[model samples]
Target chain A: MTTSAIAEALRLHPGPVDLASIETDAAPGFDGKKADGQTALADLGSELSDLQERLWAERTAGSERRVLVVLQGMDTSGKGGVLRHTIGLVDPQGVRITSFKAPTDEERAHDFLWRIEKGLPPAGYIGVFDRSHYEDVLIARVRGFAEPDEIERRYGAINEFEARLVDEGVSIIKCMLHISADEQKARLAERLANPDKHWKYNPCDIDERAFWPAYREAYETALERTSTQIAPWHVVPSDKKWFRNLAVGQLLLDTLRGLDLQWPAADFDVEAETARLIGEAPVQ
Target chain B: MTTSAIAEALRLHPGPVDLASIETDAAPGFDGKKADGQTALADLGSELSDLQERLWAERTAGSERRVLVVLQGMDTSGKGGVLRHTIGLVDPQGVRITSFKAPTDEERAHDFLWRIEKGLPPAGYIGVFDRSHYEDVLIARVRGFAEPDEIERRYGAINEFEARLVDEGVSIIKCMLHISADEQKARLAERLANPDKHWKYNPCDIDERAFWPAYREAYETALERTSTQIAPWHVVPSDKKWFRNLAVGQLLLDTLRGLDLQWPAADFDVEAETARLIGEAPVQ
Candidate 1:
């Protein structure tokens, strides 16, 4: 499939989002097998690198436009994996990635978006949030960490906040790495079985598995309420890791292409600079 | 040559230094043409990635150790190049990079090390400084940005600060990317020649080229005064971008290998976690 189609295919339409109906293992809008998808993703790297440099250059020229990728999913849904394989393709200098953890006392004292605003990328950057504001809605709603009225208020607050970001030239790509409960079980089993991966296996992950249905319902509600025209969520089927990487890579590429970035024009006379450099005496 | 030997060969000894004598185009320890060096660097990627992961995992197990790479160079000397090619080999998530620009009013208000301390990576991270506290001695002396006594004081202060960090488990890899005056002129010319690269060119870079001799003398003094037993400097011959990348890559690999990082043992019962995961009911 064409790269642009990948975004349209994976983007959650406005309305109810029945994540259970989505196939976790399916490579939507992608042709061929896993190897082909990997190859295609690799092919996209150079173009992504060039476009990202253009975006970075534009920042030097006073453009405030930037891209923010928000990734959300259950544990072992391959958030880190996507970060390494997909986002890793770009120059790390131009990318700002934040992996938000549980809020500190200081952060908890302020509005949830305060910490998030601090993490936003400046002009000419591709900002990545490994997990972001959605958690305040997802886990907070699933575990009853907040009141129902507070949770309801957050949905609107988030929508308006995102809308304002979009208005200010921040292009946000929100992705839910959709994976199956069975897949999560298998991944957890693998982590438990491997001595090398022991650091990754947390016991709380098992406790969270008990709330799978509630988490799924929370995701559905979050997706339905906040997946707006300005900033939509893409339900990336992540059972196949390669496809997940490819889908996100294509989404980023399309978003950058949509901007049609150009190299910033030089603010100085090239000839004058070249002559000045040539005339400079060599150091003894 | 062994990677360990790469570090030894490039390491500036504890004595007087001569920047003019070093051949910028020569690959001192690496025995290969450009293609071979490129392949060698590429080959180190997986091992670098594995070691970096282990270092990251050890942090979760309460290990306070981390790695810091400090890169210094003249304009067009490839500090950014090393960042993109060499340091970019590792996972960006585990790396914290800071590019020190001209000091802001806030930074200049306090002692020089204040900003450097703020940028230090936490446990389990690999911190990269594009330019660092040495600037207090380098530019501050060359351009009369600070008093001679203050510049002299900074050299001692920097040594003590770095020694303390080393005492606390931060391994410092301080590299000064060395390039010839002829090569700087060539690179500056190229930047002026290529419209796409104009963003990287600054008219002030041309002005800085006039102070070449003073800057080299300043670098020599800085290297002589501050190459501590704990954090010795390595002069990376950076005229050949490929060798510069390879030398820094090998330096990083050798340092990470020296740490002998191992995955942290599980703090939870694996069997119980597996059993709990297997027993969880699947989501409907």
Candidate 2:
């Protein structure tokens, strides 16, 4: 079967996005850019752009409703590209994106939730958590930030936290940006191979590979435990970066469209301003 | 003399919510509610929700504008809180926030702008740079990320980068979250006093103290050279967390309100759906 067909079947079935299944058999390396490929991407971007505009409006009018997106993935899973593409499509004012870094002394001082809560999005706004509170349960769980009970407590806390936010009108959209192990290794190797990309890697990241199973368990546990009615998980296939971007872009656009945003009635003299600015519709 | 006075001035100045001056001393201690004393945090949260909604609609409408918020300050300054509160007021769908961590091997590989550009918010979105491209110039100038020419080159790149973002409809809002040196000690001491907080303290944080003077010089240079018409720095006095939250909240509210967001015309079926779900509005 073609990669897309295989991807579709996996998505339709209730299973994880298998890291081993991605086929990376293409003959290596680049020219500049493929004309058709670039055009296809451009076309997709334009189509997504139209939807993004509408979504932006819905976000404003549905001001009562907001979207919270949680992106989780192995390193080099196109999180940045997904973020970049998302940015390319929407109005920056309505959007807020966060890439969680190592906890600060201040952040460590408080419970993880304290820092995460501090970043909660207001109504009618879109907030993206590049790595989210899930870290507390995922990394912290394996790293031993707390005991099993504590981890269990946080899993419940996460659900309740998201539920409350949703009930209060926040739409929590969780995405597991999935990429294959080989794919990740390839990406990591690229970073190592290219001096320019070296800054993105950390020796610690390689060290963390030893604990991949532990982290996978942690992620699975958190995902299983926290995936609830308020915020369901979309294990987005990320083997193909372009398709991943398109899928997410479409999802966001669809959600925003569903919001039914509208401008409020003018509190000021709109007729005067329109006439002044556009100078009388030319008697049309 | 008081930070509140600046806040008062920001309020009095014509615009959206008053862009108040926030002295650290005037910031509210953790009272467990809205940092702005007049409004319960719950209320502010609700208000933020409203603002978020409107801003989002405007964003999705193809305005394709972006907002850059820069927060700089002394250690233990209110930068984290500002980040938290700002994100607190918006939806998470269209935003990404990145706090510059110690350069990773991969990151150190590329030019400074490489990682930074990776974090910039997309179109019609808001990206909050906790510590941003400023680091190349700030830390390089202070900690020496590169040689002198590199630092100087970064400044030009910064100006150009920001200009590019602005030219592409990015509206930059920069703030220096100011805190007193004494406050830093008090906070540090507080952390030290608590055993639970011990892990939070990195000896490196104190090590940075040795370079405080150097860091200050770097910051001054950054402010002088990099702060421009497109991205002027707002020096916020964050001695008081509440006042800081209040002032910044006003700043954001004011900025967004000026954007004049409105919902699109409601669709014909919106009422039908509303009635289908909420059983129609009361007679009115």
Clashing pairs in 1: none
DockQ of each: 0.74, 0.02
Tens-place lDDT digits, model 2, residues B150-223: 88887888889889888887767667666665566666666555543343344455556567667666766677
Fnat, model 2, is 0.02
True contacts kept of each: 0.64, 0.02
Error of 1 at A272 (Å): 1.6
Tens-digit lDDT string for candidate 1 (A1-284): 23477887998888898988999999988888989999999999999999999999999999999999999999999999988898888888888999999989999999988999999998899999999999999999998888999999999999999999998999999999999988988898999999999999888888888888899999999999999988999999999999999999999999999898999999999898888777777655
lDDT of 2 by residue, A23-86 (tens): 3332112222245434444565554444434444444344467777778887787777777555
Count residue pairs with overlapping backbones in model 2: 75
- Over 4 Å off, model 2: A1-41, A44-62, A268-284, B1-284
A7: Cα error in model 2, Å = 12
Provide the lDDT at A279 for model 2: 34
User: Residue A262 of candidate 1: its Cα lDDT?
Assistant: 95
**Local accuracy by lDDT, each model:** 0.91, 0.60
